[model samples]
Target: MSSTSSTVLRAEHIWLDGKLMKWDEGNVHVMTHALHYGLGVFEGIRAYKTHDGRLAVFRLREHIRRLLDSAHIIMLQIPYSEDELVEATVDLLRKQKQQFANGAYLRPVAFMGDGAMGLGAVNPTRVGITAWDWGAYLGDKGIKEGIRAKVSSFTRNHVNVNMVRGKITGQYVNSILAKREAVLAGYDEAILLDISGFVAEASGENIFLVNKKGVIKTPPLSSPVLDGITRDTVLKLLRDAGHTTIEEVTVTRDALYIANEVFFTGTAAEITPVREVDNRQIGDGKPGPISKYVQDTYFRVVRGQEARYADWLTYV
Candidate 1:
């Protein structure tokens, strides 16, 4: 990932509703239902500049589908179809080609517009897509040298209280608080546990651990964890790379402390290795060999260096 700060780099235009508009012109009213009630769904996607000098989005369709699925789960109807949203994303990226020459992070959000203010109000659903230049989410140093994390006092949302399947905007409050708690406590990130006290995930990423015998384990989706796209990709990559002892099961805090390696996987964090948890050193306090391999392969596949996963990329 780029070493630059992860600030949003302004672009020429943004896709709003059904058309491209000036970035600054794309605005939402303060009275928007989603703004007040948190009735919105969104997705995070990345476009990469390939080794051959082509620009492509990683798993574009999958991300879009997930966005739509999230909306459906929240009962927020998006006005556009899947194909329409996909084209709009490609169009927005094409228009911002010069500004995001290095690649960009794409955010597609669907929310309720200004209308009835009641909690059960049925409002017009509005959609927007924005692309901007962003760098390593956990910082470049943390990615390379590994990071310190704390098991958050905050528990992951219960599946009954919050729709775990949906990436709803309001649902992130839990993550924000946990992340803030960790950062304020002098840690690099936060790891949330399920209500049952099993390891769930990081603030915004999925968690994985490698045991002493080379067995890899992660909390099952049955836990209050998001079905992360990067988590799936890493699992496939690791298996193909001959690390076949992967399992999806409940994990404890002690399990992470005693693991040979621990790492985070997500669209933003990518494959960030966890070197310490609760101040306990992890595997020599460095990015482990397996974590490095996964990170290296993930970057290669995203940058179009690997041809086997070519189908996963959508050229812009």
Candidate 2:
């Protein structure tokens, strides 16, 4: 079977509500409130294979906490507790044999269920957790050789327009539209601008720029970007490696064309270098030295090679 098809077939079961069942058995009604109104919250998490031949979930508690926070922001009352969800994730990972062998992606979602039909209709919330072996969010080639991006014409949603802090299901429509635009325009990804034309982020990843001074800079949380867990990990790793990391730095679109190197961070994207933006080559048109350093360090940390960050891993 093709690799993509094989990956899709790998997950035989999923954790629904509080029980493990056949993947096909997990279903939702057609009139699900969240489906109609986009009133749901979710989290994207990954488990990794450590160098010592052990399976571990990176930053499990933090991801679970964020999931709870997102649900709270959207007024979706998750029936299960944080500890319950964490245990469910571990249990689900343990049940999936492929995950134990090669790591996997875990998705935990809680949304309003089918009940009332209006905008103000109150309904019970439903939860589900599923996982499957998956590869890089951007193509693997992009990870090794770097990717090309364009400044998207679409502006990111202002904070007032949506709760930027929450991973609301509906908020991703903006990203979807921008990603489609980038793909149609022959770019690997899109760099969205905040309402004010300041650098925000890629469709699903956080953007970072490294200048000649060897300093790392990314948009502040106040910008129209998700406060990514991987973004936090990268900044911490950079500073721990003796590089200065700056946040909330306003980066103009023109600044990207002149950056020594540009990269993106997220649970899926990891650390992907941007070789070009809007036809402008960053530095020498290769992954910058600082980008490589951070990417290398991040890979090691996630794989349990970095002893100092061992606490970040939760073994299965």
Candidate 3:
């Protein structure tokens, strides 16, 4: 196994195929079925360094449950129960305390191993869990000062064509294309529209817009958006903060242009405000009051400052 580097930090150990292994030794066969067919499901979870100096994973159980649900959706049965997987994640983190001293990002994935080589192939299932220190995915500046986004020429997957509810590994090709297009075109992020021209979501994040009327709106599950955990947390936070006008409704692209504020949410992006869409400045081209409030509150809740949301944290 190779030693860690400044640009690339490897966990001391990783959980693979039901056991812990050295990080460099956790390799799969070259002909792994999922590598060719993209038949897999996964989840992105985060652990936070609490205010009192403890490490806690945010919504760990919920993320594990969703991973199982995604596997079920694609008919790929994971070998372990949700509780077992959760324990494995905790154990993995425990073994990497120094590496993940500040916080960590966990990826739990289940996929098909090498076997038959066709679309209808049935192969053995393999599960792996990896954790590593990570920072703001969209860049720290993007999270604080807000980011610029463009409505991608690529459309979101139609409901029947791809399973929108499942975080399937193969299904993210659409997101990759959109994200690359945006980056190549000099934009920070991409916003994809649904088939019917309704605003869907960012490449890998759920979107929320605050309109001129102080109403917060996001695309419903009926739309082609993912059921993002961070999106759910933000909704709950908004309601608990006594904002009564939160609504899950169909939104058009033009609505984003006219919105007083826009933002993206996900395990990776967290609460990232969108300062501009296609060169049009959003609310004076700065993070709006509501966006900043939600971002601040989210960080606090994740880091264990909000006692009311303690149930959402699982200590490592």
Q: Per model, state how many residue pairs clash.
A: 0, 0, 0
Candidate 2: tens digits of C-alpha lDDT, residues 1-316: 1111233534788988889999989999999999999999988898999999888999999998998999999889999998999999988888875645678888899999999998999899999998876787787888887899999999999989978889889889998888888878888898999989999999989999987776668999988789899999988887787765565587889889888999999897888999999999998988878888888998898899999999999888
Q: lDDT (CA) for every model shown?
A: 0.91, 0.87, 0.92
For all predicted structures, in order, the TM-scores are: 0.97, 0.96, 0.97
Q: Is candidate 2 or candidate 3 better by TM-score?
A: 3
Q: Please give the ranking of all candidate structures by lDDT, highest first, separated by commas.
A: 3, 1, 2
Residues 1-316 of candidate 3: C-alpha lDDT, one tens digit per residue: 1011124356889999889999999999999999998999999999999999989999999999999999999999788999999999999998887779799989999999998899999898999999877678788889889999999999999999889889999999999889888888888899999899999999999999999999999999999888999999999999999999999999998899999999999998888999999989988899999999999999999999999999999999
The candidate that achieves the highest lDDT relative to the unseen native structure = 3
| Model 1 clashing residue pairs (backbone) | none
Residue 42 accuracy (lDDT) in model 1: 93
Two-way lDDT contest, 1 vs 3, winner: 3
Off by over 4 Å in 3: 1-8
Question: How much does each candidate deviate from the true structure in C-alpha RMSD?
Answer: 1.9, 2.2, 3.1
Clashing pairs in 3: none
